[model samples]
Every structure is written in structure tokens, then in C-alpha cells.
Target: MGPLLLVVVVFLGFSVPPYLTFDPSLSRLPPPPGNHVYYPLLVAHVLFGTVAMVTACFQIWPAFRNNHRRGHRLTGRIYVFAGVLPAGLLGLYIGWHTAAGPSVRVANLVGSALWLVVTAIGLRAARQRRYGDHRRWMTRSFALTMSIVLSRVVNTVAMIVLMPQVDTTFLGSAELMRYSAASIGPWLSPLLLLLLADWLLERRKPGAARPA
Candidate 1:
């Protein structure tokens, strides 16, 4: 978890500054041609997603959760309402309208939809006072929430492997190669994280108390 939090911090530190000025020119990925709303939406997504990432660290911290139950619940609410809710909603629109190519578009759509759904289920479990269910679902939610970081790692690695094949496999189109590599990470990262989350959950004794 410490490493995860550090990654989040480092990601935000590097990624958020350019957007702080609200300059479309500074966008990491240029918005699709003539999609005037894209930059604004990107800003919103990044801001709220930042909130989600930060709050999630606390939400999953065993020491924090154990020592401050009320803080845990409060942070959980903030994470859901202020973080994933807005970020996920914006992500759906961004995904649908992205210019990153069909593969990345599909990945964005699926990942955003799944993120929203998993988060909703987690919120529902908490509302019903099902701590165990809530913990399981939120664990999955956290995995999805943090998928962006892992996706970056995956994207970097994929780019490294795919770059050399661009002339043959990508037909000399760097754009295609870029988007294709970008696509794999979004789809693959969440799946890996969710599997890890479930595996961790399964290792626990049945009916065990929710993790602090």
C-alpha cells in the first residue's frame, strides 16, 4: 500500500501540473479534432480522479481504518461522492469521444463502465450495512480506481515491446502503434488488479471480519 500511495503521488505530481492552467495545448493527449468540450472534461476527470486516488489510500489503510472507524467511513463517502462519481462519469464521455483509435476507445468505454458499476455496487453494499460485502466490493473498486497507475506501467511496457514492431505490425503508422499499445493497458490492468483483489479476499477465512 505504501508503494501504491507513492505511485499515486508521483503520478499526480507529474500529470496534474500541465492541466492546472486549463491550457488545451498542455493536454497530455490532444483532444480529438473539434471536440471543444474535451479539454474541460479532461480537467474535471483529472481533478476528481485525483480526489479518488488520494482518498482511496486512506480508505484502504489498515492502520487508519482500524484506529479511526469514523474517519474511514467519512473518507469512504468522500471517495465515492466527490471522487469516483464525477471522475467515472466524465470518463464515460471521454471514452466515447476519444480520438485514440477504436482499440483505445473500446478500452476506455469498457474500463469506465466497469469502474462506475463496481463503485456503485460497493456503495450499495455499504448502504445496506453489509460490511463484508462492502469490503469485498470496495476492494474491487479500489483496484479499478488504481488501475490508471498500473495502466501507465503497462502502457509503457507495451510501448517498449510494440515500438520495434511498428514498421511491420503497425504498417509504419506511429499513431496506430501508440493507440494500440495504449489500449492494452486500460483493458489489462483492471483485470489483473481485480483478480489479485479476489485472490487476496479468497485467502481469508470465510466469515472473517472485514479488514481494517
Candidate 2:
């Protein structure tokens, strides 16, 4: 049920962008002050984001369902091929191109770096045939991958909360706060989940029995 909700949020977040006609150009670094590689970098970021979000929706399926058959294998391969690979590459590209400001750039770099690490760990765990480890790592990856949804949610909430505190007309300030929350908050969700999973796994291990 939770995974299904995550899928819905991710689908809506990614699907809305191309049609909105808003200036995604807001993300690009302006000329002279911006990196020469910015355009290619931004393009790569969007490409990977698209792929990652789509693929991430599938990563949770194996966890939710008991069927690990040929169909699962085929879909998993496609997910890795189309989603994880592009996401990792594009995440690295965007991380390197992160801006110099004391705001969104830091969050972007951190999110991208975390995504790369978690995704790589997921791949490695799968390679080692560690299904439990793989699931945990993939959970982390999906958590990071869903930053797009969280970011928007955070922004919307912020706008509503801050409406009474200041002039909500300042979309730029509101956006900055939203971006920060979205990028940073999502990281925490996975980290906490990883820690909890580890703790639970340890507790369930043999010889770790409680006195009760």
C-alpha cells in the first residue's frame, strides 16, 4: 500500500513537468556566471531523473509481491538497463555541475551523491545474491529517487505554513525553502529506514535473543 502511494506520487511529479510550460530554465545557471557545461549537464539530469523515477517504481514490487519469476527477471533487467544506469550517470554529472550558491546547489550535490552511493550499493548487493541487502539498498535508492515528489510536497506545505508569517507572493524564497526540504528531507527517510532495517535484522539474528 505504501509503495503504491509512492508510485502514484512519483508518476504525478514526473508527468506534470513536461506539460506545465513553466520555465525549467530556472534551474540552469545563467550565462557568464554559469558553467559552460551547464546545458548538457541539465539535460543529463532531466534524462536520468525521468528514467530513475520510472524504474524506481518497479524496485519496490519484488518487496511487495512474492513472485520472483521470469517476468520479474525481465522487468528487473529493463529497470536496471533503463533506469539505474542513466540515473547514476546523470546524478554524477549533475553533482559535478552543482552551483556555487549557499542554497539549492548543496542540496542538489548531496542528493545526487547519496543517490549514486545507494544505487551502487544496490547493484553490488544484487550481484552478490544478497536479496535482503539488495532490498534495503534499493529502498534507499527509491527513497532518494522520490525526492522529486517530496520536494514538491515540502514546497507546497511551506507555502501554506509561511503564508501567515510573510508575504507568500515571494515565490523565489518559497521555492528555495521547498527545494531544501525536498532534497534534504527525502535523504533522511532512507537513512532512517536503513538504520531501522539493520537494527531489526540484527535483532532477528540467531543468538541475539532477548531476556524476555
Candidate 3:
């Protein structure tokens, strides 16, 4: 498998099983108190998000797309409809209802919204036979899709850096430090990844010199 696919698979392996158990105790973040629908929405989001991640590998695999055009198209459709669409919508609901605090809510809201919009535009470009545009947009979409992985990394670093300052900066509230770290992950990861994607896309343009 390509490195990207391998990374995604490893991420899924580590992250998805707990949710599959349908046990609230296994959730990475606790559901909001008295929010009857929160757990269910989170589960649905995870299931569909898994679909998106898996199918996205096939959609981006050059060998598969080049050698098996029909399969590529099929997987692309699955990625859009069955994967991102439901996942993105469910994520919005979950984000809105999360107990993680304001920064996290904003991050989730913006990230989910951007994922949906970028993917939809990519699909539209593909339908219009604007392959270049389609590719660029989908690159951004994929970056957003994989931002979850980067978010984890960012969260870890943020937590480590913030931990030392908890007493002074966070007023000795460990919970506040944790929430602050959590807040950085969702938005910062996607923002950085999207910028990277844009840079890569620009370099691939016609007449641009290939990277050494």
C-alpha cells in the first residue's frame, strides 16, 4: 500500500474499534450530559467516516484509477455519497452538541462544513469534465478527510506544551488545559493540510517545473 493508505489504515485500526463496540465508555470524548442523540450521532458519524477513509484510498490510487477506470468511478461515488455526505452531516450535529467547549465546537463546525463544500465542488467539477479543477478540489477534500490524523498529532503536541503551563496559564485547571489543546486540533490540522494541498496543486500545474 502507498504510505498515505498505510497511515490511514493504521489510524483506523487504532481509532475505530472502540466506537464499533457501541460502548460510551470507549468514546474518546464523553457525550454531553442528557443529550439523548449524541452517542447515536457520534456512532453514525464514525461508521460513515470509516467508509470515507477506506474508499478515499481507492479514489486516489493512481494505478487503480488508470488501470480500472470503472472501479475508480464506483469508489469515487461511494466516497462522496455513502461516505462523506452522511459523515459530514452527522459530524455537524455531533459538533454542535459536543461538550468539549467553544473552541472545539467552532473547529468541528467549520471543519465539517468545509469538508462537505469542498467535496461537493469536486464532484461538480468532475461531472462537468473539468478534471483539473476536480483534482484540485478533491485534493483539498482529501486533506480535510485526513485532517483527523493530523489533529491527533496536533492535539498531542498541544497538550504536552500546555501541560507545563496549566498552573499559571490555565489557572491550575487541568481540564481547561485539556480542552484548550483539544480545541487546537480540529481547526489547525485542516488549515495546515489544506494549505499544503494547495501548494502541491499549484506545483502540478502545466508549465510548472517538476519538483526535484
Candidate 4:
């Protein structure tokens, strides 16, 4: 089920780039309060988001496969260099420039920090040869990576649920739903994914809790 969901997510992750282009002007707050960093920050956001999503998809194969080969190590190194580092930096930058309320900004900041921490812990655990710890931390990191996918899912659901009662046009309703999704989506998605991953991991390998 997880793999199936991940396949659907990967399809959407790849599909979104063609259908949606970032418009800097759309990020600006109206009239008196304008966020100057909005456009550049959004550009950075898209850049790093693409990096993170693509690389993250490659990071989990070893967990599902029997062969933990040199290629896995090389890919993991690349993922850390190409995905995790840039994601942490860009996420914090974009979070600072977020146009929404403080709550949204704070949530994003927390998520970004947690992403960095989990990635760092995972790497450190691997270096120390604590395979179980490494697995748990990597699971946490991947869960964070799924935030982008889950955010879209939440937005789609919100649009479906909220659109029918309103008289708004499809585009307007979608726009509103997107905003609602972005605001709260990042906050909830990572944590939810973490819990789900932990539950699944425990079920699959009850001895996964044992020390390596």
C-alpha cells in the first residue's frame, strides 16, 4: 500500500511541473503590505522542492530490497548532497518569505528544522553502525519528504469538499483551496506521515525496535 501510494505521489510530483508554473505576482499580499522576497523565494522553493522530491524517492529503495549495495551508498550520498542540504536551506528561506500569517511561517520553519535534524541523525546513525537507529531516522526523513505529496492530496480533498457549496468558479475555488492547503498542509502532513511510517515499520518488523 505504501509503495502504491508512493507511486501515485511520484506521478503527481513529476506531473505538476508541466501543468503548474510559479507566478511570483500571485504570492504578493495586496496593497499596503507587500512581501518583497516572495517571488525569488518561491523560485527557490520550486527549485529545491523538485530536488528534494526526486532524490527522496531514491533514498528508500534499500529498505524494501535485499541488496544493500555500493550503488545504494552512492545514491544515498548524492541524495544528501543534492536533496537534503538544499532542501533545508531553501525551505527555511521560503518559509521566512511566506505571505500568509505567522502561524503558517512558524509551521514551515518547524518542519524545515525537523527535516534537517532527521537527516542529520540518520546520517550519524549510519556512521556509528547503528543500523536500527539509522533505519528509524531515515524513515523519519522520508516521512518528511512525503509532505509535498500529502499537501497536494489535502488540497485536492479540500477543493472537492469546499467547492460544491460555494458559488465560486472552478478556478477561484481551486486557488482558494491551494492557499488553504499550503498554509496548513506542510504543518500536518510531515507529522502524520511520520506516525504512519512508524506504525508500519513496527508492524513489519517487530524486532526493528531491537538494537542492531
Candidate 5:
């Protein structure tokens, strides 16, 4: 688990810089058809998402949460307010503007919505001193935040596995099939990941002790 987290952290750490600079060489497309606004928003999303992602790592570490409660709380504030909030909002806009297809766009909306709602719930829980709920909500939130990475991985694998199975002759365009595969991955991966996470958590949690 630690190793996996480290890898994700590193991936996100590296991913944010290209967007920060807005280099066309690293861009997915050419500014989305004349919309100057899109570029800045994409950059903002990456920046905020990066902050949230980095801070979320420390926030979730049991050692930091348990031993350095003060630091945890401080980091939580930044994660929620500075990291997830604006990033999630901007992400929705980007998702809407994304060119692939409705599936990709819808996936973005759902992912961004989950990220925002869960984080908001976590922040509220913390304010009320319901630390347990806060932790749970934040866990869910962080999962969606990391879904960006998961989406890419899933997209790549799906493109590899499913693209070949797609009969482009009947389907009209192979490009559309490719887009579908990519979109399917991003849309499906988050729900699958969230369910798996919940299942593992439930299994790991101790059942109520029998009355002695």
C-alpha cells in the first residue's frame, strides 16, 4: 500500500508541471477550438488538483493523522479549501469541453462532482468534530481525486484490449471506437475503484465484540 501510494504521488507530482507551463508539446489538443479560456482553466485545474493530491497523501497517512494532529488539521484545511474546491469545479468545465465524447464528458462530471461533494462533507465533519466521518468522507474524496491517474491507466488498458475487438468497418470510424474505449475506462474505473475500496475497508474493520 505504501509503495503504491508513493508511485501515485510521484505520478501526480510529475504530471502537474507540463500543464503548469501550458506547453503545447505536452498538450492533448490545440486549445480546444479557439477558446482561450480553456487553457487557463486547464492549468488551474492541474494546479489545484496537484495541491490537493499532494496534501491528501499526508492527510491520509495514519501516522501523520495520529501523531501530528495539528499538522493534520492544517493540511486538511489546505486540501479541502485550496486543493479540491477550485480544482473540482474547473475539472467539470474541462470535462464538459473535452472533445472525445459524451462518455468522457459524463465521466468527468461524475468524478468531479464526487470529489467536491465528498470533500465538502469531510470538511463539515471536521468542523463538527466528527473525526471518524471526516476521515471516511476524505478517503472517498481522495479516491476520486486520484481517479485522474486511474482513468489514464484504465484508458490505456482498455484501448489495448478493447480497441482490437471493435469492428471499425461496421462501427463507421475506428477513431470513435478508440474514444469510446478511453471514455469507458475513465467512467467505469472510479466506480469500480470506489466499490473495491469500500469492500476492503469493510473487511478490514473489526466486527462488534460479543458481550462477555
Candidate 6:
């Protein structure tokens, strides 16, 4: 997990009250397919994803695991079964009503799917005693999870810092920015982070904790 991303997700997860409440206006979510189910589902997604991130962050720390093996297993169980599984599935459901449109929907759907698959692989590897593989795949899983934070980073850059003043084309100004975030940015995020993880791992010696 990225330090900045861990901090951002942890803080945002706690700070956003309207997200966890019945009121969806302060939630800033797009209108769901039906009025009845969207808000509750969104709240569940937020809560589960936040808890998952917290557990995942703790899992990455060698000191925590070294000291508390049972706690590590407990957190891993929460991260996978309770936190990521339902949250990822709910994210796919919520993708239909995303403000960023189809590209974002596709991105999120694919990302969540991969997050589940990768994390499952990690969990399986651990079960089989492949600790290094578990470490690697979990890193990939959390990298995808961190896409939420990077979405804002990309949106800030593409929409505010890099937006052209005199550009009017097929896509509107809003479309350009939001699409850049939802579609384009996240596709590149996990790949880049995974590569960085690999490089950092190489720098550590022949055998280490696999860079988490």
C-alpha cells in the first residue's frame, strides 16, 4: 500500500459522514438505477472498503505480523472475506450509477474484479505456504484498491492543472476531466505501482519480505 494512499483512504473513510448516512446529497454519488437500493449499497461499500484498507495496511507491516501472528491472520480474514469481497461486489453494482459514465463503469468493474482475483490468489498462496507469492499478489491487490485515491490525483491534474482553456470538442469539459479520471487514470495506476514495487523489491536483497 502507498503511504499517501493509506492515509488518504483512512482519513476520507472516517471524515465522510454523509456517505455513511441515509442522506445521499452530501454523498455526491450519481443517481442509482433505482432510488431504493443505491444509498444503502453505497454506504455499505464505503464502510467495507474502509475497513479493508485498514486491515490491509496492518497486514503489510512486518513488525505487526512478526509480533502477532494470530492478529495478522484475523486481519487477513477481515480484509478478504468481510472487507474486500462485499465491497468489490458492491462497487461493481454502484458502477452502473457512477458519475464518470461508461468508461468509468468499465474501469471500476474490471478493477474490482481484478482486486478480488488478485487478493484471492494471495490468500490461496498463503494457504499453500507460498509466502512470497502471497506477498506479491497482495501488493498487487492493494495497489488496485488504492486506485480510489489516485483517481482524485488524476482528476486534479487533468481537470484543474492541465485543462486547456480553449478546448471545445466532442467531449464536454466535464466529460474530459471525469473520463480522464475514471477511465484513463486507473488503468495505468496498478501497473505503475506494481512496477515500482518490483523495483523496490529488487533493491532489497535476494530474499526479503517482497516489499509488501
RMSD of each: 3.1, 5.4, 1.3, 5.8, 2.9, 3.8
Clashes of each: 0, 0, 0, 0, 0, 0
Per-model CA lDDT versus the true structure: 0.91, 0.60, 0.92, 0.69, 0.80, 0.75
The most accurate candidate by TM-score is 3
Tens digits of per-residue lDDT for model 2 on 1-212? 57666666666565646524434455433323545665555555566566666656655664634665565556556556676666666665565555434455555667667777787888789889997787777776766666656555564565566555433544547555444444444345445545665676678667998968
Q: Considering TM-score, which of the candidate structures 1 and 5 is the better prediction for this target?
A: 1
Per-residue lDDT for 1-212 in model 4, tens only? 47855674676566445324565434332212465654555555556666666566656765633375676666677667677777677778777666655667888888888888998999999899998898788888888877767866775676567666444644556555546545667777887899998887887686566545
**TM-score against truth, every candidate:** 0.94, 0.64, 0.96, 0.72, 0.89, 0.83
Better of 2 and 3 by lDDT: 3
Identify the runs in model 3 with alpha carbons over 4 angstroms from their true place. 210-212
lDDT of 5 by residue, 97-205 (tens): 9888888888888888888988899899989999778777788887887777777888888778766666753265678777777787777778877887676566656
TM-score of candidate 6 on Cα atoms, chains taken together:
0.83
TM-score order, best first, reads 3, 1, 5, 6, 4, 2
lDDT of 1 by residue, 5-70 (tens): 788889999989999999999898789887899899999999999999999999999999999999
Deviating ranges (above 4 Å) for candidate 2:
1-40, 62-65, 95-100, 166-212
- In candidate 1, residue 30 scores what lDDT? 88
Task: State which candidate has the highest lDDT.
Answer: 3
* Window of ten residues with lowest summed lDDT in model 5: 163-172
lDDT of 3 by residue, 19-100 (tens): 9999998998788888877887898899899999999888878899899999989999999999999999999999988888
Order the candidate numbers by lDDT, best to worst: 3, 1, 5, 6, 4, 2
